[model samples]
Target chain A: MRITLIGSGNVATHLGAAFKNAGHQIVQVYSPNLQNAALLAYHIKAEAIDDLQQINPNTEAFIISVKDDVIEGIAQQLAAHDKLILHTSGSTDISVLLKYNVKAGVFYPLQTFSRTKELNFWNVPLCLEGANENIFKIITELAQTVSNNVYPVNSAQRRVLHLAAVFACNFPNYLYSIAQGLLADNHLEFDMLKPLILETADKVQQQLPAAVQTGPAVRNDETTMNRHLEMLQNQPMLQQIYQLLSQGIIKMDKGTNGKA
Target chain B: MRITLIGSGNVATHLGAAFKNAGHQIVQVYSPNLQNAALLAYHIKAEAIDDLQQINPNTEAFIISVKDDVIEGIAQQLAAHDKLILHTSGSTDISVLLKYNVKAGVFYPLQTFSRTKELNFWNVPLCLEGANENIFKIITELAQTVSNNVYPVNSAQRRVLHLAAVFACNFPNYLYSIAQGLLADNHLEFDMLKPLILETADKVQQQLPAAVQTGPAVRNDETTMNRHLEMLQNQPMLQQIYQLLSQGIIKMDKGTNGKA
Candidate 1:
């Protein structure tokens, strides 16, 4: 399959490299900033372009992997050919592209990507949705070339997945930052919490998170909870976070108990 | 050294097995319920005792690996011999043991333990603090026998570490449960989010979370955030959590930027 990647961010770089490695021809790499496009294009042996009109018309699929808000504008600028047009966004609807092209689809890879890090693309879950049966089969076969885990998900399900991802990945990373800040203030090394963090994530791979919940909140150890709250008195925002998250854990536990 | 493990919970079982493997004798296993005591005792070839009076008089160290509130009562019951006494708690002060015994210390392994899972005790971080230099050396030597990573942490620092653990470990886990619930509500498998969860944790191993923060919150994408809040309108608690945590992330990013 001949593919053109539009965007030069983390997701674009990762997927471009992956598609190139899977024996697909990357016909062009497009970004408003040609320097950014060239850097990624240099690695994948693809032509880099700054203008939307410069995109290769001979390319079979054009994947727009820009920011969520920018997807619509980029899609509108692309010349409508009989070729497939897909956006690699989790939250945006498939309709965003449907307005511009009949062969519109979504090719969302469900994993966090960092440009500096190398990813094993084989394990990344690719959630794909196409505008029609013919379009879905095309994207699904193309996705299967890069990853073993591929699912045919609709726009509604992908939106829910994106919301859940914020809770699972983004929000939890913020909590870890808060923990690191607390340790730094107390003259403690953040290394102490690394093993625990890894283990907590590892546990969920084998068991449900609700079944494995542990802490002062789940145990109802008020003494420890109150002490933690008092210690954070100087930081009102942290104190509020502590109270709210703890209550959330307790409430979830009660809900689980009611079902049991 | 001969040790007696007081309590038959997750910590007690893991520590008891580790001590036995380290070429130390577990002289007795004690619990208020003899049946629970006998189960762990059978694994380590130790006598099981329900009454504190039945604890071996000649034991070198008594490890009280029970609940935080129960540690004091159990410590008070053990006959005060001129021997080391330790509690395996992250939040409780070493002073709790000091009130009952001249030889008091804290042997806190900063890891979440489950009775069904086997732990690699060699990697678990052992946070130790003693009432005096002599007691410190005794517990430190004992801890080194079990784990390679041992730190001499004071009560204040340990308290802060415990508080941080809740943020780094417990709260993130609850957020994972929330993600799981959201997925289940929409007929998606929890497996879809596991890779993202693991990758989020792995990112922190090499970089400070603040440096690597990514999401709508950090990106300041108000459009996506508003969409998420609207989707979560029926669940007020989740709505509150999403708003608070997103605000916290934004504030932290601002602080990092200000420092730069």
Candidate 2:
């Protein structure tokens, strides 16, 4: 498939490279910033375009991999291309694709893309949706070229998946940052917690995490909880996070429907 | 070095087996529960003891690999022997070793250990603390035999490390459970997020996490946030979590203090 990648950020840079590696030709790379576009275009043997109007008429698919908020504007700009136009987003509506005259769909790769880290795109779940059956099939084929896990998730389901990803990835990192802050404030190494983090993740593959939950909160070890709280006296927001998350853990253990 | 394992729970079971693999003679395994002691002892080709009185007097070190609350009680029980006793804990005070007249120390492996998973002991961080230089040397040597990352973390530092571990491991898993719940409620497979979770963890190893945080929260996209709140209307706690965490990310990105 001849692809035109719009947006040269982490997702575009990595996915474009993967698509190119999979023998797909990236005909053009589009970014408002020429440097960002050129960075990815250079890797994929594609021409760089700073304007959506410059998107060649021949590319099989135009992937709008820009920020979610700017996606509508880009889609409007690319509405002329009657080629398949897809946006790589988990949270936004698939209807945003309809604003463009092209065969529209979503190509949300369910993975955290970092420019520094080369990722295994094969494992990423590509949640795809399209306006028509033929378009869906095409996008699904494009997604399968890069990933083994392809799901025909509609906008609503993809939105839920995006929300869940936040809980799993973003929020967890925030908690890790807080942990780092707590350790750093006390003059400690962040590396000490790496083992624990990996084990926690590996456990999910083996067992239900709720059943295996441990700590002062799950054990209801008030003494340890009190000590931990006392230690958090310096940071009120962290204290709230610790208290709320602990309560949430306790609630989850009891099979209570708690906050997400 | 000859060693005795003084407990038969997750930590002790894994550690004893690893040491046995490292060609150390686990002279004896001690536990109040006869069956538990016997089970571990058999795995390590060592004798099982039902009481503290049976702790072999000749063992170079007895790792009190028990629960945090039990370390002091076990130390009191071992007041008879001066043999080097160390508790495998991150949070417990190193001073607990002082209760026994003999040499004492800490041999805390800074990793989450479960009897089920096969772990490479060489990757585990063994945090050591001892009453004297010779004891420290012996414990450090023993630690190096099993692990690449070993350091003499003080009691205060260990306490902070353990707290940090809760954040990195326990809290992250709790957040993962929350993700699982959210997905399950929507009849989605939690497995779909595995790549994202692994990638998120992989990011911190090489770069700062905040530099790559991408989500509706960080983007400050109120449209997605509002839709998410609606989707989570049935889950009030998750709704609050989504709101608070999104707000926190926005604050963090805005270069403002992430206060309540």
Candidate 3:
């Protein structure tokens, strides 16, 4: 299959390589920035194009891996092409591309991509959606070349997955930022918490998170909770986060909803 | 050094094994539950005692590795002895032992311990606090034999470290629980987020958490945020958490105060 990538950022860089590695021909790389386009194109042995008009009409598919807001505009620019068009966004609806293109779909790769780090593409899960049965089969084959786990999810389910990811990835990283702040303020090394962080993440694999949860709030140890709250008097936001998250955990333990 | 453990819980079990591995003698294992005491004692070749009266008076140090509330009571019960007394608690102050004995100190290991997991004791940070210089030196030597990182953290500093740990470890685990719930509700596998979770944690090592922060909140992408809020309408508690944490991240990015 021949594919053209419309962006050259982190997602584009990694996806371009994965597609190329899986024996697919990357026909072209398109980006407004010539340098970024050339950088990604050069690695994949594809031509770099800075103009939207230069997109190959003969290409099998066009993957718009740009920012969420820019995706709809790019789809409009390439509306005349009869090729299958897709965007790699978790939150954006698939219908955003329907008015602009005849055949549109989503190819959201559910993993964090950083230019500096090497990711095992096989382990990354690919969440996909398509406009029709024919396009869905094509997208599934393309996705399976790079990832072993391919999930067919609708816009609503994909939106929920993205929201859950923010909690799993973004919010926890924010808490780490707060932890780093606390340690640096007290002249302690950040590495001190590395083992604890690893262990905490590992525990969730075998058991439910709520079942394996442990801490002052989980135990309802008021003395320690009060001391932590008092210590965070200067930082009102962290204090509030501590109080709310603790309450959430306690509630989750009591609630019989999911496995938690 | 010859030591006697006053509890046979997670911390005591690990610490006792680490001490024995480091060529120190564990004189006895004491616990209210004789079964637990005998199990730990059997592994370390030590006597199991259910009564405080059976404590070995001549032991060099008594490590009261019990709950925060029980440390004071145990210290009081062993006050007649002249040996050094220590407690493995992060929130409890070093002064808890001062009212009872001649020498008192703290040996709080700054890592989450599980009875089922094998920990690399060498990497665990040992935060030591003592009542006097002599006692501090004795505890530091005992701590160094097992762990490579040992620090002299006062009670106030220790309390703050423990608080930071909750943010780094416990809070992140709670967010993971939320992530798990969202995925399970949508009929997605939790394993889908493991790679993202690992990368999020690994980013903090090379860069500060604030510097590497990503996602909709940091970008202030209102469209995605609004969509996520709508998806979470049924879960009011998760909705509140999402709003608060997203607001906190946005505020941290705006504030010039901490390293964040």
How displaced is residue A64 in candidate 1, in Å? 1.1
Residue B119 C-alpha lDDT in model 1: 70
Residue B72, candidate 2: alpha-carbon lDDT: 90
The lDDT of each candidate is: 0.89, 0.81, 0.87
Q: What is the Cα-based TM-score of model 2?
A: 0.95
Candidate 1 TM-score versus the reference: 0.96
Candidate 1 segments whose C-alpha is farther than 4 A from its true place: A254-260, B254-260
What pairs collide in candidate 2?
Answer: A259-B237, A259-B238, A260-B238, B82-B102
Q: lDDT (0-100) at residue A77 of candidate 2?
A: 72
Q: For each candidate, what TM-score against the reference? A: 0.96, 0.95, 0.93
Error of 1 at B185 (Å): 0.7
Model 3, A41-143: lDDT tens digits are 9999999999998888879999999999898998998888888999999988999999875699999988777777777888888999999998999999999
Positional deviation of residue B233's Cα in model 1 after best superposition, in angstroms: 0.8
- Ranked by lDDT, the better of candidates 1 and 3 is 1
Please state the CAPRI-style docking class of candidate 2: medium
Which candidate, 2 or 3, would have the higher DockQ against the true structure? Answer: 3
* Model 2, runs deviating above 4 Å: A99-101, A254-260, B253-260
